[model samples]
Every structure is written in structure tokens, then in C-alpha cells.
Target: MSITTLERPAAENDGDGDDGTGSGVGTDAARATVAGGEAPAAPTRIPSKEGVEVGPRRRLRESTLDERFNILGALVAGPTVATLLFGWFTPLTGPIGWVVVAFLAFIGFYILLVSLRSDREEVKDRVLTVLLISAGTILFGALAFVVVYAVGRGSVALPHLNFFTQTMELAGPLDGLDVGGISHAIVGTLIQISIALAITIPLGITTAVFLNEIGGKFARFVRTISDAMTALPSIVAGLFVYAAIIQLITHQRSGFAASLAISVMMLPIIIRASDVVLRLVPGNLREASYALGSTRWRTVWSVVLPTARSGLVTAVILGTARGIGETSPVLLTSGITAVMNLNPFSGPMISLPLQVFDFVKSPEPNIIARGFGTAAVLILLVLLLFVIARLIGGKGPGQLSDRQRRRVAQQSVDDLQRIAARNHLLTPSPAPTTQESSP
Candidate 1:
């Protein structure tokens, strides 16, 4: 037999020097073809950029600090420049016009800077983000200003312990802030709100449940009416109670009458908000409860209400917030009196809002200070109510505190053990097998 040695073309192996071993399987195949006395086929080479391995690239992350600084610097610089330019060129006296101009300038400058580096989509996103943040900042700033102004103006009265403890009955409108207090107003406000909540919470929640669960033609009509009533003016609500109950039945203005008016104002808000919240309850929850042989009411109580409990509380709180600050209704229904009147049924009562209104209308600067003081007190009371509501509402559905979780686990264990015990009792023991061979 003749020995055959495979050799590759010199041109093919120019850059990649052959060290006896083939470059790859393709090189070995080409050599084999040549050794077989057939013309060697050209090897296929993979095309690639020198010293590069291509793959997907990762996106860059945001420079949060730098971006924040940029935004802040723009806001400051734009406002300052606009104010200076407006003062030099025009006779603009008010800060409001200057602020508007500055805001517009800031937005334009920010967008221009963003467009330099970012694409259209990114620029749009940044612009929207800045606008939203600016709006939020303005809103919070206004709120802070109000609170600060109230507290500062009221400090004249607030420092006196008697301002919280004593009544305004003995003190004249011109009396010093240290002499009189808003004790009656505080008491009246609480009593009226409590009564309103007592009346509205049940009726509103039931109405919402009716709208969502037993919806029909009547339900739709009720829903439409409630929706319309949400926009009803406070004075209109007071007038309604005045006509319906106060005039026809009571024949006098009282805290009870004021509660009726407040309830009227609050009912629609509660019903509408609760209805929305209840609708958000997952259908699967209701279906699961039914699958377990639960009735509609039982399912609502055990599963649905618990699931939406937090939201329901929020609805009630919103209603309270809306009604709490109402001056017109309280002024109309509950006649203002400086002296404390505890009786909600017979005598005239005055709430914080009414007290504030009465005080502010006075010509005395001291009385005006008392009005701000009352307003400050009202703000604090609202904040306290909010905190209380949050605490009472507790955890949302499917969320349990550590202690609650342990209790539930223990209860479950007890139930499982009871079930196992009952099954053992129901299941008969096998008959004792006889010793067949022993006999």
C-alpha cells in the first residue's frame, strides 16, 4: 500500500501557522480530501470584526443626584432671572405674574437642555416629570403656608391655657386673647360630627351595598341621584334639612339640626366613594365564598367588607373632611352661641367653623386672632381624626399582624385537630382479629 500525506495550501495557512494539528474540523476535512487525491475544497471562514464579540448592550441608569440638582438649579435660576427682567422692563408689581412667567421659562429651559442629550421620548418624560413635581411642590408649599399662617396668627391666643379650657360667654369681643377660649365650639363640633357619622355611616354603606349587590333600575336611579348630590352646595344641604326636619319637626336650630344637615352633605359622598371601593373587590372572592356555601350577606360581612374595610374607612374619612370644614351648613342649622350648650336636642350650638366665622366678622383685632386660633384648632383636630381613622382601619385584606398571624395559625391547628378527631370517631375500628390457631 502507498502511504499518503495530506497537505494544505500555503495560502490557506498563511496567517494561522499549522503546527501539525489542523486549525479545526474544516481544515482536517480539506486535508483529507487532498490526501484522497481529489481537489481540495476552499474552507469557510466566519466573518467577524477583529477583537470584538458582539451581544446585547445594557441600558444606562439615571444619575439621581445630578438630575435633582439640575432641576433645582433651573427652578431657582429661571425664577430669579424672570423676576429681574420683569422688574427692569415692565411695571409688574405682584409676585404672581412673575411666578407664572418664571415657571414657563423654567419649563422651556429644562426641555431645551434635556433635548440636547435625550431623544424625543426621554425629553417628553422628563418634562412631564418636572411639571408633576412642580405642581406637587406648589400644592404642598401653599398648604404649608396656610398652616404656618394660622399657627403664627393664632399664637397670641394659643399660648394661653384658658383659650382651650374657658368659654367665650364671659369675655367680650374686644377682650384680650388670654381671657376667652373656644371650649364650646370644640364640644359642639365633636357632638355634631359624631351624630352625623352615626347617621350617615350605616345608611351610606348600606346604600352602597344595595347599589353594588342588588343593582336594578331603582339602584341606577339612586346612583344617579347620589352622584348629582355630591355636587350639591353646602348651603343647599342646610336648606334641605331646614325645610324637611328643622322647620317641619324641630322648629328651632340646634346641634341635632346641624348633624342632619351635615349628614345630608356627607351621605352622597360616602355612598359614591364606598360604591366605587366595593366594586373594586375581586369577583373571585365572592365566587369562592359562595363555593363554600356562604350566603350573600355572610360573604359580604366575612369576605367582601373585610377586604374593602380600609377603603371604606377612607371613604368615610373623606366625607368627614368634606363636612368638617363646612361653615355655611353649621351657621344655618346650628345657631352660633359663645356660651357652651351641651344639649344637642334643645339649645343652640356652635362648631369650630361657625366660631371662626363669627370671630373673624368682628371688628376687634383680638377677635380676629381668636378666629385664626379657632382655625388652627380645627386643623389639628382634623389631623388627629385622620390618624385615628388610620389606626382603626388596621391592615388590609390578606395582611395580618404578627400577633394576628400567630392567633390564626393556632386556630387553624385547633380546627384541623378537631376535624381529625371527628373523622377518627366516625370511622369504625376494624373488628378485632381472632387468634384462629390458638383455639
Candidate 2:
């Protein structure tokens, strides 16, 4: 072999090793010789430590006792505890034990149904929803039961017309007495609520309108003030009215004073209600009115107000209901009296709440029963007001008169079709052909 041939073989071996193109031991051996004198050794592997398996019974017992107790403890210590305590113990065993037990039983059953584990997500959600609804229903029922119990206990004297007309007439301890009617209290409640509505509605509606429709620095300020008013306590309202209108403005306990106090109590509610309703009015209605060249004020007055009129009325009615039963404010401004007084500007006023308060204080069982009867009547009156408000004010002309809505809908369809035709959006009916033309 020549020198060239020997160098050629060495270059080929080096190229194979450098390029890592050869799988033969020649390349591997060359590499090993160049890097060191010997090949590298493989890494040592260590064995893993083994664990002894527990019996199935022990494993299951551990899972059940540990996880189940953990979860159960969490639930018992959480909101569920409150529910059980309130639903079972507070209402059932104390003053109103029967009501509490029933409430708790309902809650427990509902919780059990909801707590059932399921594979279906929708089913689980639905179960939870049903449980919540059942709980709410139970809670409400319990509350109603308590109210009914109190009222029923108090309503023993309700059947007699005298209950409505009578006042406290308990004279001697032995010879239990007969009282007069609650006509005065009834009159006072009506008068105070009416005045409260009258004072609150306009002020509230205007304030709400300004806040919603006319947003500016001043409007924002007014809204902030109204929000503050919403949190004011009834007692505070009474005190304010007592200090300002009753003592400072005029030093006499009269229906007017009571009205002023109630008005104060009602103002925030009406403002908040009207604000919510006004805000709910569709922006499209406002824009449509503006498109017709209507002024902002006119558009708001005619279109927006009318559209939200039902809701606004409901708000006012709700506010009135809230103001009607308040005793503290009325007590501060209008001293309690048995005689009926309709005039708001003069004389002491007796309201149902005040009557109930008075009777509950009496030691006689009959008077206490009378208080319950009064409470029931008060609740009835509130319900009546709600119903009337719905009938008269909440139902729109369209809803109240189905025929009118049908007529309007029919007229709208005709108008739309005519417009569509005028716009060439639909093909006109084919021209009629004479019978002779059939030839």
C-alpha cells in the first residue's frame, strides 16, 4: 500500500466518526479512543421501596371515616348549622316550637335530596336548585305559619264586628272589660299612608327621572343623596320628623305630623323604586321619540313614563305598603288616640300598628288576642293594596283589554305588509286574468 492509500483509509475512519454516520464499531471505537482510552460505563439503576397493601375493609373504613367526617364536619359547622338551628330549635321549641320543627324537617329532607351524589352534571344542578327552592319555600312557610299563629291567637275576637270598631275598655281585674273599635286606627293608617304616598310619589318620581334621564354632576349628587336616604332607619326618620316638623315646625301631635313622619320614611323607598323602573325603560323608546322630533322632556314624559308607568305604579304601591305599617315614626309625630281622625293637619292619630303595640302590652288575654287580630287585618290590608295596585295601575291597557292588543297587532301586520309592498320587499299579487283570456 502507498502513503496516499493509508491516509485515505484514516481520513475515511475520521470522517465516519466525526459525522456520526456509521453504526459500526469502527466509528464508536474511534470516538472512544479520541475522547479517552476506554468506553463509558452505563448508569446504575436503584430499586424502589415497596409498600404493603392494606386490606379492603381497612381502606374503605379509612376513606369513609376520614373523608366523610371531614365533609360532614365542614357542612355541620357551616351554614347548615344555622339552617338547622333556626329551622328546628328556634321556631319549634321556643315560643313557636311547632313552626320551627316543621321548617327543620323540610330543610333536612331538601338537603338530603340535594346531597345525593350523581354522575349527571345537569341532574346535580337541578337537584341543588330544587333544594334551594324547597328551602326557601319552607322558610317562607315557617314565617307565614308564625305570623298566622300570632294572628290567629290574636284573632279570637276578630269575627265580631266589635273587634274592628272597639278600643281597649278593660276596667277591673275580675270583671274583664269590653273595648271600642279600631276605626280610629284604621282611619289613621289610611290617612297616613295616603299622605305618605302623596308626598313621596311626586318627589320620588321627579328625583328618579332626574337621576336616570338627566345624568350630570348635580344628578349624580342627587342620586348619591337618595342612596343615603335609603339606608336611613325608621326610628331615625321619626326622630328627624319629630325634631324638625313636630317640635321645631309646629309643637302639636297631629295627623299632619304623622303624615310628615311617614312621608320621610316613604321618600327613599319611592325614590329608589322609581329610579329602578325609570332605568328599566328601554333606550329604544327614547330614541324613537327623538326620531319623531319630540323634545327630550316630552319624550320622557309621554313615551318613557308611559312605558314604565306600570312598574312605577307598583314601586309607589310597594313604598306605600312599607310606610303604612310603621308605628315608631307615627308614634313620635302622632300620639295614639282611640277616636277617629281623618284630617291630617290636626289631632292625635291611631294606626293599626300602634293598636297592636298597645294591645300586646296589655296583660289581659283578650287584648292580646285582639292584637293578633289587628295584625292579621293589617296584613290583609297590605295584601289588598297590592292586589288593587296590580289591577288598577300595573296592568297595561293592552294587557287589560285583550281585544285591543289583538286589534293593534292586526293593524301592525297590515301596516308592515303595506310597507313591505311599497318598498318592493315582497312581490305584489299577480294581476287578475279574465276568464275569456283563458283561450
lDDT of each: 0.86, 0.71
Q: Please tell me which predicted candidate would have the highest lDDT against the true structure.
A: 1
Q: Per-residue CA lDDT of candidate 2, range 65-181, in tens?
A: 433543454445444555566676565335355455544554464445445543467445644665687689889988899778866686566777766765544322233324455
Error of 2 at 353 (Å): 0.7
- Cα lDDT tens digits, model 1, 1-439, are 5411123333334434442224444455566777995645534443335422122233346466656666877777788878887888777777788888899888877887777777899988989988898899999999999999999999888989999999998999767877989999999999999999999999999999999888999999999999999999999988888888788999999999999899989999999999999999999999999999999999999998999999999999999998888888888899979898999998799999999999999889999999999999999999999999988998788888898999999999999999999999999999998876965
What is the C-alpha local distance difference test score of candidate 2?
A: 0.71
Model 2 regions more than 4 Å off:
1-117, 120-124, 166-179, 396-400, 403-439
Model 1 weakest 10-residue run by lDDT: 50-59
